[model samples]
Target: MDAVVKKIIMEVKKGDQQAFAELVDLYKDKVYQISYRMLGNVHEAQDVSQEAFLRAYTNLDSYDMNRKFSTWLFRIATNLSIDRIRKKKPDFHLDDPVGGTEDLNYYSQIAADEELPEDKVVQYEMQEWIQNEISELPPKYRSAIILKYLEDLSLKEIGEILNLPVATVKTRIHRGREALRKRLRHS
Candidate 1:
């Protein structure tokens, strides 16, 4: 942890509410990004991110000072995301026609400045498709893949977040990649 972050965490532990807000400011985007990647819904991601911080605040006393704070917080968020995934049945699709319009897709309705070049449009569509496929993955593999690739965390860091051994993280990533490749090949 950075020294400044360490000091802020210490202050938070000492019951300084402003210190906790500072921590939220520092990590809210990251938490939301991870949640968005995992959940693939803007509203659900926001809700999950908020819930993660709330949970962290309530359980702050249980946090081990020796462990990386981000890792601990991420673990909480990841577990909550997994639980949400298991509870909800997916009723939405990215490619679904927007609000019952037969011709317009959800993506086509997204406002863009100027006109995107053909290559950029193709690349953007491909990225969106990949993200959709990722959201379909089992929670275990999805968490590993998102943490490793999207978040660019080291294997050990991912392992810590997911509460798994490094080798297990590696296996999950490998399997997740293989599944994605198979999906691409079929598509």
Candidate 2:
């Protein structure tokens, strides 16, 4: 909604590839973050981020100037992530080995960074656990929760992004939080 972004969007609509690139540079990290949070895989996040930009470019003319561009862009990315989740088939490998009976030698073979303080290690582990639990959520709740908490968007913004009513968005967030609380409590 800033003047600078509006100008860039105008230039992009006028076929300025550099302007589009600038827009990508501005939002790539945010898009990737959303994708990564939703998919929990670096490669898939990267792919989704790229695809979001590509889709935005292709659909540029359809973008409504009256609305916030970020909302529209995020909606596209979230929908694509949801589609990817729905399409994912369980992966199985017939030849894959089962549980490891090997010794602790493999742990030493892998290189690790400098050790963190105890507090930092515990905090990092807790964050990872929470993220894993979030990943287990249904896509609707996951999208609502991530957009609200991780992206720190407003309830109305989240409703717009998910194409739901504000009341529905609030309900989703409440349900999602309750689900997360249950998961955390169980663990």
TM-score of every candidate relative to the true structure: 0.84, 0.84
lDDT of each residue in 77-173, candidate 1, tens digit only? 9999988888878558757888868789877877877999999989988978887898878888999999988888999999999989999999999
TM-score computed on alpha carbons, candidate 1: 0.84
lDDT of 1 at 49: 92
lDDT score of residue 129 within candidate 1: 82
Model 2 agreement with the true structure over 104-150: per-residue lDDT tens digits? 44345437688779999899778767778888888899999999999
RMSD of each: 2.6, 3.9
lDDT scores of the candidates, listed in order: 0.88, 0.86
What clash count goes with each model? Answer: 0, 0
* Model 2 misplaced stretches (Cα beyond 4 Å): 91-123
